[model samples]
Target: MKKLINDVEKVVLDSLTGVQAAHPELRVDLENRIVFRGGTPRQGKVGVISGGGSGHEPLHGGYVGTGMLDAAIAGEVFTSPTPDQILEATRGVDAGAGVLHIVKNYTGDVMNFEMAAELAAVETGVRVEAVIVDDDVAVQDSLYTAGRRGVGLTVLLEKIVGAAAEEGLDLDAVTALAKEVNARGRSMGMALTSCTVPAAGQPTFELGEDEMELGIGIHGEPGRKRVPLASAAAVAKDLVEPILADLDFTSGPAIVMVNGMGGTPQLELYILYSEVAKLLKDAGVTVARNLVGNYITSLEMAGASVTILRADEEMLRLWDAPVNTPGLRWGA
Candidate 1:
């Protein structure tokens, strides 16, 4: 229950205020809870927008900048943003080119974003397309998802697709690239501890001292199963095996991310990454580029997730393109 906040109800708003103050290069519409790049929307450039519940920092919000998301809408912690709010963001960021909504495959998120797209079309004649990410190989059905939950691959999708958009790719081309990225990626997560939502003031779930939950979702929902705690290498095998089984990453270069689920320290994340690298090499998957650390998190939950994206030459080149954002920045 110990949280660094003034009021439980104001957590999302208060944190967004801080984000606005910290990054002057971005524009924060506090009233609408939208974050956009601090410049004119490039003419003819496809607009990329993604949104979801709050608490997963540096996600939809931290990614708003050059060569990434043009705008991000925020909702209450673990809650979907309203359709009106998403519509505002779409209108604000839409240039002559259409806007692409990079929606995760959660039910509420999908529904809300769809509603927003429809509203934008009817009200302003803004063209909108959506690319739903459901790369989590955890469970077929969950509390919030129909097939698989969108997990770490959302981060990779935003990066690669953003680069394509920045390169002036049209909306149709960007949408196609986004779907290709989603199809080529797979993710699996584990949790050593549960997270405490600020409003709830209690842990969402519990884990025994010698236990771990595999195939965990980002919202602290129950994972596929609980298992006795084991060595880092064993845990790495469990995560990597499912992702490899779900996709044939051996066909080309791969982009690998060992993401920390908030409370896990960098020391342990590196240890996990080492094991993941070893396992991928043994499976004949060539790692062309890798990202390690807490890119996508589940509040203060202690654990990590593995995301693997099979990359062709075009995907790899786009990934190397310059990106400048609060969460991810390089070559810019």
Candidate 2:
């Protein structure tokens, strides 16, 4: 209820206004609610784009730039972008090579993006492909998704696939790499507290001070279980264990992320990260590169998610490529 906004209905547009002001290097389309990498599209490079509801800042929108997504569509908070909005982004970002839609596994997102892809191909003759990120090991079906919900692994996938596209890979190659990244990654999340969506004017869910929700989704959906609040180490164990179980990380060097769900602070995130690292090491999982921060978040929710990607040489090389974006920038 204590949100900083002028009006509930205008929350998304108002936030987009701030995004436009804060990141001048990017192009913001207020009407369509799309954010694009400023300037002309790369002639031969595949255009990489993703989108989802608002609230998960630094996600689809914050990632639009060099070595990452070329454009990102912003829907209403926790809502899917309409097919027309998605088609607009697809058409705008498409150069000669084609466009890649990196959609999460949410049903609404999946359906809308599919419809947009069909429209773009038939109406505009722009080749479009999509990769659905379903790396959450937490649940097979949620209120919003028929399969596992795409969570933190989305950030990692976007960076790697965007690097491939920036390298001038064809649409087919870029899409393949994206699918590979999605296949290799697994994520699990936990929440210490719930968050209030701006329009709702109240918390999405409530959690007792002494309890925590394990295997939580990014949109405040019920997690796998609620249990007594535990230590960082115990929480890390609860998260990392499922991911390790779902995918084998011991085969090769891995890319790991301990992402905050908006409201969690860095101090606590590092504490949790250290414990996660310890667990991975104990399991003989070799971590090559790691990111620890709030790359993807669930608006003001106090929690964290762990994403592990089993990486090979190509993934590692692409991951090391320079990226320039508001949410993640390095080497550029």
Candidate 3:
């Protein structure tokens, strides 16, 4: 209710305008809401395309730059882009090398992206492959619902896979790298409170002043449970334990990211990271590379998400590649 904006319906349009204007190296397709890599799609190199909702700023669009995504499609706030939009972007970015769609594991997102791929196969010879990230350990792979929500690990996937694409790896190679990251990564999120979607115009869920929701989804889906607020160390344990249990991060070195859920501050993120470091050390996992910030988030949801990636030599090499984007920059 307190959000600063003209209209809830125009949030995506308004935000994209500013992003395109600020970054001259990027080209925006307003009608389609796809962000291209500021030039014609290069031939003989694999095209990387990613997208989801709008509130996760500097995500799909922000990462569309050199050594990153070739194009990014934007959906309505917390909603999936239409299949037609995704198909257009897929066709638009095709340069004979094929295109990869990096999609999160949300219901609408998965369904829409799948439909788009089907359309692409029927209409064009542009080969499309997707690597679905279900790294969030929050949701159990149950028989009823979508298994898990892709969360913070998605940010890492984009960087490493993008680097592989920049290295001129074939579509299969890049997708393999993307899958490797997804398989090795595990994430868990905790929410201090729920966020209100502009369209809904109300809080998605409620948490008491002294309670927090654990295992929350980015769009404010109810988490596994809400518990009384606990100490930073206790909360960090809540976030990290599920991830550690979900993956074998202890057997080798790992890359760790402590991500804020939009409303949390850097200071709190670091405080949580401190406890995460201690816990990982105790678990016999080595933190090789670490990022502590808001890489992925729910809108103004006060909390954090922890992601751990088991690293290998090849992944480490790609992780070091230069990347220029609004959210992350490295090696340059």
Residue 50 lDDT (model 3):
88
TM-score of decoy 2: 0.99
- Lowest summed lDDT across 10 adjacent residues in model 3 is found at 136-145
Candidate 2: which stretches are off by over 4 Å?
none
lDDT per residue as tens, model 1, 1-332: 98899999999999999999999999999999999998847778889999999988889899999999999999999999999999999998899799999999999999999999999999999999999999999899999989899989999999999999999999999999999999999999999999999999999998999999999999999898999999999999999999999997656899999999999999999999999999998999999999999999999999999999998999999999999999999999
Candidate topping lDDT: 1
Q: What is residue 267's positional error in candidate 1, in angstroms?
A: 0.4
lDDT digits (tens) for residues 113-135 of candidate 3: 89999999899978999999988
Q: Which scores higher on TM-score, 2 or 3? A: 2
Model 2 Cα lDDT, one tens digit per residue, 1-332: 88789999999999999999999999999999999999848788889999999999999899999999999999999999999999999999988789999999999999999999999999999999999999999999999999999999999999999999999889999999999999999999999999898888899999998999999999999889999999999999999999998996657999999999999999999999999999999999988999999989999999999999999999999999999999999999
Computed on alpha carbons, the lDDT of every model, listed in order, comes to 0.95, 0.94, 0.87
Estimate the overall C-alpha local distance difference test score of candidate 1. 0.95
lDDT of 1 at 242: 91
lDDT of 3: 0.87
